[model samples]
Target: MNGCRAKGSWVADEKDTVHYSGAAGGWGSVRGMTEVLARERPTPAALDTLRRQNKPGGFMCVSCAWGKPKHPHPFEFCENGAKATLWEMTSRRCTPEFFAQHTVTELRDWKDYDLEHQGRLTHPMRYDRATDKYVPCAWDEAFAAIGTELKRLDPKSTVFYASGRASLETSYLYALFARMYGHNNLPDSSNMCHETTSVALKKAIGSPVGTCVLEDLEKCDAIFFFGHNTGSNAPRLLHPLQEAVKRGVQIVTFNPIRETGLERFKNPQSPVEMLTGKETEISSLYLQVKAGGDIAAIMGMIKHVLSTEERRWREDKRHVLDVDFLAQHTTGFETVKAHAEQLSWEEIERESGLARADLEKAADVYIAAERTIFMYGMGLTQHVHGSDNLTTLVDLALLKGSIGREGAGISPIRGHSNVQGQRTVGISEKPELVPLDRMAEQFAFDPPRDTGLNTVDACEKIISGEVKAFIGLGGNFVRAIPEQVKMEQAWQSMRLTVQIATKLNRSHLINGEVAYLLPCLGRSERDMQVTGAQAVTMEDSLSCIHGSQGNGHPASDHLKSEVAIVCGMAKATLPPNPKARWDDWTADYGLIRDLIEESYPEMFADFNARVFTPGGFYKGNAARERIWKTESGKAEFTVPTSLSALGLGDKEGRWRLMTLRSNDQFNTTIYGYSDRLRGIEGTRDIVLMHPDDIAAAGLAEGQVVSLASDADDGEHRQVDGLTVTPYLLPRGCIGAYYPETNPLVPLWYHDEASKTPASKGVPVRIVT
Candidate 1:
């Protein structure tokens, strides 16, 4: 960790120069090149030993959604996964006495990195506003207080927020607790990122999950990756991409930025490549599309493919359409064909920011492949027309008869480890009729009929005084939500705020009138239940459900399992009723799984027995087999209009800013201070700009500038002193990390269809 420092500043090396320039506030800004060097170094042997996987053992890496290892790489973990692993296995601790000395106000000023770096919490803690400090409290006392506050407020006025990081068993218990309390305001992390995917998939295919599994990826002749950077976001997928490249699979990458992962990836596992310093070439063809332009690009490709099919039919009597499959499994071919024929290339190129030649080239790749896969990420969903973008991709997949094939289907790479699992086990605020009716029949209580508030709506309710309390299961609510000022104010206005967290964070700092921080066990920490030391289950991005057992001891003997804590609070809050059986469930996680099986029998059949498998089982996807689940029992096509009409306007000289994360960061959790692949060290605040745009803005390389959004409120949201880093991105486009540039996004700005905050495509004006 040694480096040169001058007046609290340090010089950066070649690799560190980029990261240091972009470093955000906190440890990233304070540390220099040394942090980058530390991250690149090989992982310690102790960590490798801890991550050992056997036929029956702990859960897989939660950091990325890349499926189980296809061919075992020497390093089982990716860089970001390693960071998450190390952070969870860190040797830091935060005791009750430490909280007693540090007041909530004092901790509020601390950076997010510094606060979390303080270490894991050992026991339950309740804030003492009288002394301006937190004091240790017995579990019973804390539960009683939580029960009292929950009882005081109407069920609808209380929000139960869950993060995707929580275990399936714990999430099930949480949902049960909320349902027993007679509210459905369960705003989990899925609502923020993949709600669009859920909504779009349900509308078009009748299923909310991806149709393709990890193994299916290897079978595709062509893969179209849109709006995702697999290298940094899901590094484990690099191995598959490397394999695909070696097999001569045509990979087409459609993104606004030329991501490093899509460009050239050096597989650390390949002996020759690693030894010779050779890199695997990925993305045979890379197309740079503008933000919010995904729909146009997809439609354009579909149009070109259809045209090619028509030409082939006229020349050789060969049809690209799978006539038998379409007749039996689909319904919207006529409408889709009509729209594709009518779409103008000019409109497509204008909206998608892709040239006509690029669209044709992509279509050529698609037409040549017998089977193809379409994969997308949040970049496709964080726009005003996110649903439209997703629908177009589905349209393309369906047109080529890709669905229900071996290596061909639509895949949405969800971020959180068990994000899909949480949604599966009923963490959704908007429960369909089937699950609700079943829940009522199983528990013998009429489930809440009215649709609940989403993440954004919940925050709005709190700010508008419609909600009086907030209870979070595992996420950093304040930091994750949009409109930080309003979110912070809402937390302060709450009558009670209860956070069941494994560590300290910004959410804990935003204290309520009656605030409590109940320290819980981390995922890497052992959970002791009545049965014995129990392992929690998590569903990976690919729908593989597996068990996770903590190798490390609990931060302290006082820390309780999240499931146990939820049961304790539920017992204290619910009216005297034997049906609740909160006590029996608290002693063992198996009991909770049994209840989940009772509620969702179709999805969780023999949950306990199935979880012991090595690779885990795949949750059934009807669309995977080309069984259309849409209203028409077919994959529907959506005709995309203008991006300008969507209200993502590019005024006179302004550029659209897409926020992304560095390799060192995972969501809001800053692991270290550098992004190695991006050649950035000790920095997260710099903005990536096209070299031409930088020059046009009268800004030189390494020069700092201020960026502001033209919101209606006239609020001066500026990120001052950001160095301009030149990149090969398209002109009138800029990139920066979220939470850092969150201020630039307007409170009301979000996808109209999904209500997800549009963190990706935001229009901003920069000044020198």
Candidate 2:
């Protein structure tokens, strides 16, 4: 096992942590544009490709799931968007010759960044276990191999995994193909990132999505940002935040790590500000909440609002809790209010790691604002009580009657481009969301009726040799999950593993007894099918359904569209029937949408006409319309009301370790070695620690140490050589770059309800 600092990318000469984060956008963004393009895409034509990103008729950014505005500003793509578009539209290619030159073992030893940087996968390949290598295979041969594997296994034992990058049409067709092949084992990347956001919001709001659209950003009076680092992960969001700030909207940010993007942003889109070196302040009150303490922080705000409203009612007969909305549109308000009132200010301040005065000040702004929106990400959703964390946030939104109105609602900022859409289009393991009976009526196939394995459960089943076939549609699942050391071992035991991807990844390198890599066209690449160059539909974070048509040439002529790949595999696996019409749907994606409309008539009516419209149609959230679908047919208010649930109160020397994404990367993809805004110069090995904790742990700045998990999961989980440096973090808390720190996150350490990996708030002992 290698220490993080011992990796090829780490250099000891580099400083451990930067004192401050750079302004969100400016010359640094331009520098990122120049550097990433020069290294990967080196051509003037790349400029034209970047210009088309997120344009109504052009390709969507392959980075974040942030929605495109109805009236989008000029230069819709952000710094990371440019890099992602160019990275996908790169000139590099991973041809058959490259695989022939490197064995599976040899390529497995290469770094993740290097494997992806090698470029687009040019052809379908099957692993030759005898030769310890992969050889190019004909599309038919690959499809036949998959069919043979599917027939060999009990269809119930087979599992399907989807990444957020898959288009809505592709996702729908995939769901159909998997059911026709005889199982509903559809697990995906959403199981890892925002499952809590979906699961919790659904229970609370009757909608498994954000209640507001991009239009809300324009009119919101105040925004309470929770957990998500908008700058590095979804830079496009900063544009709207900047605009909101200009309109006098107050912003309050809550995160364990104080991201610079939330502090100040200079829109790279504004040339005047770019040249003048001016910046816009993003947060009016930035509270550095303790890792895993968001529940306490949010609960404290709820309590303050309740007390203020009660006091105000006593004084002037004017109320603040929107009692009228709560009485009519919600249930269980009394329970949540009682829970909020019970928590003492001392308990709130201690658990949240914030001064009582600071919490009250934030409450001041929140109470004063007529309309507010709450936006959060993994920081709040990747904890021991992650689902409860989201529940409390929803309760706050409901308490204020913030939801079901323009300029106010809950927005769980998604990590990937179409992850939400993937779930909506039936990529889940849930039996109800999958629309099983409706498919039988439409496609005339009896789909699996039982609930299937999710990502975490799928890993467990695979390890136990219960899962025979593992199929993936984008995403580095093998590495992204916790307990990678065991996951990779379990994955190798499967009878067959299949990857449908645009580029080479570590997951492809870890082959089963028989494995297949089916190269697919990326979002930026043209997918020429029997019909013509096709446009695919994707649902954004805001639930806006729009068309994404690629303008650039395919990375390689041999690459097939994801829909085509799914059809070929389906035709090979299932007995040929005139009724299925797999080929016809694959030939033209519009046919797939027509089927989707048939399945979800209320949501997708007039799908083709609406998806082509400029702004795309909102799928419409019932919660926003005050149309609740709970047991009582009303929105619910839930409060966990436990410090243990909030992950506070630990042993004296223990530190809460939070995994973070560098400004240079998105999710598992590494674009560069440094997080420039954070002042980190060249390495991802550094651990961000509060100065007080460094001294308390008998450690100094730049001291290399290992983090041993406090949880006794039978296995000792640890990440070595995590060089520590003083960072603007709460005391007893530390931050490490994600995926690198993923190993230390125990597989068993997950939210009980949502099963989301508790990547944040990992209790650890700093071993010097």
Best by lDDT: 2
lDDT of 1 by residue, 213-274 (tens): 87876788998899887867887777787788889899999988767677777765556765
Off by more than 4 A, model 2? 1-17, 42-45, 644-649
Q: Would you list the C-alpha lDDT of every candidate in the order shown?
A: 0.77, 0.84
Model 2 C-alpha lDDT per residue in residues 1-768, reported as the tens digit of each score: 122221223223223434443488888888988888787963445677677678778778888889887677777888888888888888899998998888999998877789989988899998989888889999999999898888888988999899889999989988888888777788888888789887888888788898889888888999999998998888989988998999899999998787878989998878899989899999999999988778888888888899899999999999888888998898898988888888898988888988888988998898999999999989888887988898888888887799999999999889788899888878878878866778789877678788888878888888788998889999888879988877888888888999998788889999888999999988877778889888898888898987888777787778888998998888889987677898898888888899999888889999988876777788988988989867678888886746544344588767788888887888888887867767775678778887677777788877888888777456877888777867778888889988888877777778878888888888777887
**Per-prediction TM-score, please?**
0.92, 0.96
Show the lowest summed lDDT stretch of 10 residues, model 2.
1-10
Root mean square deviation (Cα) for candidate 2: 3.3
